[model samples]
Target chain A: MKAKIYITLKAGVLDPQGKAVEHSLHNLGFEGVTGVRQGKYMEIELATEDKTKAEADLDEMCKKLLANIVIENYRIELE
Target chain B: MKAKIYITLKAGVLDPQGKAVEHSLHNLGFEGVTGVRQGKYMEIELATEDKTKAEADLDEMCKKLLANIVIENYRIELE
Candidate 1:
């Protein structure tokens, strides 16, 4: 099974890296870009074939290592 | 309009950050994990309402600034 994970900063949290990208885009004359929020994307291959088990493990992985729960949020998709 | 961009290392390209994450997962006893790839995800808000124009602009942004096309690949999703 394969898992796709997305880790993003929570609403109300400031993202300096995202701000830098937005600024750069404007400098490059992409004036239509009004906002940018950056996040982490991870693809993981799991040995288990069980979808339920994979989802549970992937969720644990996100909580334990992939995401900082205090300021970030994580979502997982399995295939 | 909103755009979701994903930037990932091309196949066969070495990813040290991904390796580190994989190793950490192993140490943490996520033994079912077989592989890991890390990437960047960005969400951008565009002032334009035209989807076609937004897509074109986003492609240019990826090529010019958001992605290092030499060793990375990017995908853009617009909504």
Candidate 2:
């Protein structure tokens, strides 16, 4: 099985790197771009057939280390 | 309009950061996790109704600065 996780800064959080990229994009003539938010994507390959246990473990991983609960949110897609 | 871009190191590329994270996950007791690939996710909010143009511009951004074409691949989702 494969799982893809997306971790991103929460709303109202200050994303300096995202802002910088947005600014650069605008400067590069990308018109109409109003805002940008940057985040992380992690793809994990597992050999298990138990998706329930896998998801549970992955959720725990996200909360414990993959995502900063205080300022970031995460979503997982399993395949 | 909103566009979400997912960028990642291409297959066969050496991803040191991803390997480190995978090792940490294994240490943290995520069983069955065999490999991990890390990437970037960027969300852009645009004020225009032109999806085609936005996608084109975003593709350019990804190729030029948002992603390293030599080692990375990017996908765009428009909404």
Q: What is the TM-score of chain B alone in each candidate?
A: 0.98, 0.94
DockQ of every candidate: 0.95, 0.88
lDDT tens string, model 2, A1-79?
8999999999999999999998998888876788999999999998887999889888998998799999999999998
Candidate 1 docks at the CAPRI level of: high
lDDT digits (tens) for residues B6-28 of candidate 2:
99999999999999998898888
Q: Write the per-residue lDDT of candidate 1 for residues A1-79, one digit (tens) a residue.
A: 8889999999999999999999999999999999999999999999999998888888899999999999999999887
Compute the lDDT of residue A61 as modeled in candidate 1.
92
lDDT scores in order: 0.95, 0.91
| Model 1 ranges off by over 4 Å | none
What share of the reference contacts is kept in model 1?
0.92
Q: After superposition, how far is residue A46 of candidate 2 from its true place, in Å?
A: 1.1
For residue A2, what is the lDDT in candidate 1? 86
Q: What fraction of the true interface does each of the listed models get right, in terms of native contacts kept?
A: 0.92, 0.89
Q: What is candidate 1's CA lDDT for residue A54?
A: 87
User: Which candidate has the highest lDDT of all?
Assistant: 1
Worst 10 residues of 2 chain B by lDDT: B48-57
